[model samples]
Target chain A: MITIKKPGLLSTIQDLGRYGYQKYGVVVSGVMDSFSFRIANLLVGNEENTPAIEMTIVGPSIQFHQDSLIAICGGDLSPSIDGQTISMWRPIFVKKDSTLQFGESINGARAYLAVAGGIVVPYVMGSASTYVRGKLGGLLGRALQSGDQVEIGNLTELSKKVMDHLHTNGPAKWFVPFYKPINPIIRMLKGHEFDLFTDASKNLLINETFTITKEADRMGYRLSGPKLMQKEQKDMLSAAVSLGTIQITPDGSPIILLADRQTTGGYPKIAQVISVDLPLLAQMKPMDQVRFQMVTLEEAQHLFRKNETYLTDIKRAIKLKYR
Target chain B: MDLQFYPLGDQAVILEFGNIINPTIHKQIQVVSNYIEENPPDWMIEFTTAFTTITVFYNPEVLFYKEVCQELSHLLKNIKWDEPNEYRMIEIPVCYGGDFGPDLIEVAKTNGLTTDEVIDIHAKGEYIVYMIGFAPGFPYLGGMSEKIATPRKATPRLKIPARSVGIAGTQTGVYPIETPGGWQLIGKTPLELFLPNQEVPSLLRAGDRVHFTPISLDQYMEMEQTRS
Candidate 1:
């Protein structure tokens, strides 16, 4: 068990989240940086989809009720156990009664904390995720508050053996490398409303940079930069909207929908950011500059599959390390 | 009518039956949606339908951009559009006016009618479920008579209560969950339009017809108490 001494900014419990419920208007509100979430789980031998604490910018302070093992990933947030600074990628064994505190992130906005057997929050809609809009899921459907207690679920056999191994010696020498991120280039496919815009609007979108506004969240990012006018369409009937859908409102401002976006929308969508780049978007803060590039649907699909394959390879490598 | 298929993203393709919202086009979308659901390819993940089109998510490894479009076109060109309704009709009970509906008087005054006449006209119409969106299980209903054609609030409230029956433009619907909305609300329904706890939480689904029946304020209070 762990108790939150300080909830910190926007720290909430999340998992891989609910799928197949978009038809019912449920947005997938899981870990935004799934790449890091997967790494945290792999380090501790937890399932890739296990629930964990997703901290944005400022992480939390937690006092453990029992001795446990943990790993921190996503964003270069300086974390310390018992006031001793710890590395970001490596797993550490903490004795009972030790307090963990995380300071402001040096790079990126969100960090992930994965315990040995996932954070045990009661399931809602087949997921342990939090969708704070309708107050559904997570720890009573809200972000972590001070004095919240989270039970560690059934610890795996591998976790116990690893913990015991660490007790005799120390931390692992080399950690799984979360590759240094490259400058983002979001590849987009033409949206249904893509044809609604003039050719100049399309050209500018491909060439210009848009800044993320403070209004961004798990739902969508409101962007500013180009106010392109539509040539043909005025109002569009509401339709099925998904992650990476770039909607242009009547006023011509752009909103890039993300994990917690509504299932459907009425705004004209100019482009959809590809699936491979959506994880990067979840980490972006207000005023983060982003540029769009056009990629054919075939090319976008190819990259998605390539990324999925890389993830599988990473998981295999981590398991081999322990063996 | 020939359907135009476009790319929503790399993962999804949308087959649009143009921009018109006639029942014939809606039925066409339903047919295409049903087909994709029944005969999915190796890479197809899920399909969501709305208005006059259906969007399909597929695994790019198995289906290419041109392949998905061609596959859909081939099937759509041959598929029959006319069919009997595939859904059941359900009735929802609502408590109109008073605290449940703060704008009931405002809507009635604009239409130059007594509040009783307004309520009678609204409850009497059997509304068609055009689609479910805006909020969970919140139905976008058609068939609201022009007698209740009221504009939306200039400034939308941050918190419109769940199960509130409201009208905007020529459309009337219920709010499934409390959300910021521009709809002019007249009453609240005791029934849960969408409950995440239940299987198929939305009380109204696409293609299902619904008629609102007026219930007493006492009954509304009793239902709320029981739910708690």
Candidate 2:
């Protein structure tokens, strides 16, 4: 058990997310940075999709109510237990009732905290991730507040044994495989509204970089860049939109809907960021920069397959170690 | 009308029933939706509905695009997208104007009618649930009386309260959640659009008809208190 002393900015419980409900207009509000979330879970020997805490802008200051193992991942947020600095990308054990604090982030905006056995938030629509707009899932379907008590699940036999063995002295071996290299190139496929834009507008997308605006959140990242002009269109018929959809708003700004975007939209979608690179976009903070890379539909599909295979291989390797 | 499908992304395809949002294509969507729901395609996961189209999201690795297209073609040709309504009709009680809706006067003034006349036109007309989108359980109801047509607010309110009934273009509907919106506000409903604990979270689903009955502010507050 742990109690939040200070939930800086916005911190909410999340997992892989609620799916199969998009037809009803429910967007999957999962952990934004799945790569880091997975690594933190892996280090603590938790399931990849287990509910974890996602912190934006700043991490939480907390105190352990029970002796448990914890791992911090994503960003360069300097987390500390009590007063001493703690290393990320590794597991650390906290004795019951110890204070933990979060310091400044060097790069990136969001961070993920993984307990030995994930946080047990109520599952609404088959997920523990919080959907802020609808107020569904996690701590009354809202972000964590100071003084909120979060319970960690009972550990599996393996996690219990692994917890006892992990070091409290220093950072563990780097899991470089899951790390998103800074300045990532996001791959994208042409969206349905691709033809609606002028050829110059389409070409501008290939060349220009977009800085995520202040109007960014889990729903979508509103981008401020070249105002993409459609040859003609006063209002577009609303259509089904999914994650990674880069919708060009009427004023010509691109809003890349994230994990928590609306299920459908009326904005003209110029492109969709490929699935494989969505995690990178998810970690970006407001005012942080990004650039788009064009990829053929075949290439995007190939990358997605390749990524799934990589994850599969990693999972197999972890299982083999335990076996 | 025949259906035409194109790739939405690597994992999804959008089937265009026709350019127009007519009753014919809506039924076609329902038929294909039911067929696909009852007998899901090998690669298909879930499909979302729109006025004249259905976007299908599938696992590319599990089901190839070519295979899905072939299977979908057969289903599209045979299955009727225009099926009769399958869901129940729900009448929602709304309290219009005054504190219930801050923009009621603005909407009434723009429409060249007194607030009471606007309310009469709005409540008397029947509404069809064309689709649910934008937010969770947000029903896009069609069939508003053109007499009540009012332009959206020049500047969108930063926070339009949940259950604020509003109009955008020719469409009128209840705001399911408290969100920033540009719709012309006219009233508020006390009912919950979505309750996570409930088995069926949304109060309205696609194909569900909703009628707004004008009620007193006292009644609205009473229902709101009951739920709380």
Candidate 3:
């Protein structure tokens, strides 16, 4: 069990998100950075879909009541144990009664902490992800508060082996190198309504830089950039939107939909960020500048498959080391 | 049926039946959605249905983009459109006017009718659930009397209470959760449309038939108490 000493700015339990419920208007709320979340879970020998604590700019101060193996990934909020800074993207064994704290924004916007057995939360619609707006899953469908005691689930054979190895060896010498960038050029594919935009708007979309406005949250990031105008205003029937759909609002500013975006939208979307770059976009904070790069459908698919292969290789390497 | 396919992203594809929203297009979406729900492919993750389109999300690792398109095209041919159209008919009890519906007078005034006339017209109409979107269990209903149609409020309310029934343009819906919306509120429903604890969280689904029945405040209070 782990007790929350300080709940930070915003922290919630998340997995890969709740599926099979979008038809009912349920938003698929999950970790903002899937790449980091999956890596953190993998480092702790947990399944990639296992629930982990996702922290915003400010991270929670946690007190572990039992000996455990854990990994911290994604944004660097300067996590430390007993005043000593800890390494990320690698497993670390913490003794009982150790206090883990975070201070100062070092890099990125969100951080994920995964334990060996994953967080134990009652499944709502076959998921433990927190959809706060709907009050669906996670710990009572809300962010963590101070003094909240969360239980850990039983460890799998792989997790147990990893924990035992970590107990013998303080921390792994090797670590997965993750690129943390403040202003990133996000790659995207043309949306269904991409051709409907004016030529000037299409050119500006790829050439100009956009700043993430203060209105950014889990749902989406409202971008302040060159106004993108459609050739003609047409009434679009509401249709399903994806994780990285970039929708142009009535005011002409673009809003990139994220993890907690509504299943369907009526706005005309100009582009969809490729799967590989969604993690980079997720780590961006308010006021961060971003540029868009258009990629073909084939290129996007190729990149997605390459990323999966990289993750699969990492999993195999970790399993070999533990064995 | 004329079908068009577009790539939403690397992981999802949007199967658009037509550009316009009509009964024929809606039925086509329902047929495809029902078929996929009954026989979901291994590569398919899940899907979402809208007015004239059904977006199928899939695992890119399991199937390439071209393969996904091929599989869906093949599956579309096998859909059993001849199956009986068994839509669930649900009647919602609503208490109009007073504190429960703050914009009742405004809605009636916009429609050039009395509050009682507005309620009668709304209650008497038979509505169809076209799609559920925007908010969980929030039904996008069709088939409303144009006599009571009202434009959305210029400035949306920051917090519209849950279970508040409202009308916007030619559409009518019930807010299953509190959200910021521009729809003009005309009444409040006692039934809980979003049940998170249940296996099927949403009380309403696509292709369901819905109608509203006017109730007194006393009856509304009694039903609300029983539900709680």
Residue runs of model 2 more than 4 Å from their true location after superposition: A167-176, B41-43, B77-87, B101-117, B217-228
DockQ of 1: 0.66
Query: Of the candidates numbered 1 and 2, which has the greater lDDT value?
Result: 1
Q: CA lDDT, every prediction?
A: 0.82, 0.81, 0.91
RMSD of each: 2.3, 2.7, 1.2
Worst 10 residues of 1 chain A by lDDT: A176-185
Model 1 per-residue lDDT tens digits across residues A111-222: 9999998899888888888988878888999999999998998878777766777787888777777555544777788887788899898888999898998988888899
Clashing pairs in 1: B101-B186
Ranking by TM-score: 3, 1, 2
lDDT of 2 at A49: 90
Off by over 4 Å in 3: B82-84
Highest DockQ: which candidate? 3
> Looking at model 3 chain A, which ten-residue stretch has the lowest summed lDDT?
A176-185
lDDT of 1 by residue, B88-191 (tens): 68888889999889988989999999999889999999887877777778787888889988999999989998889998988899988888989889898888
Query: Which is the better candidate, 1 or 3, if ranked by DockQ?
Result: 3
**Tens-digit lDDT string for candidate 2 (A77-101):** 7888889898887678777888988
Q: Which clashing pairs does model 3 show?
A: none
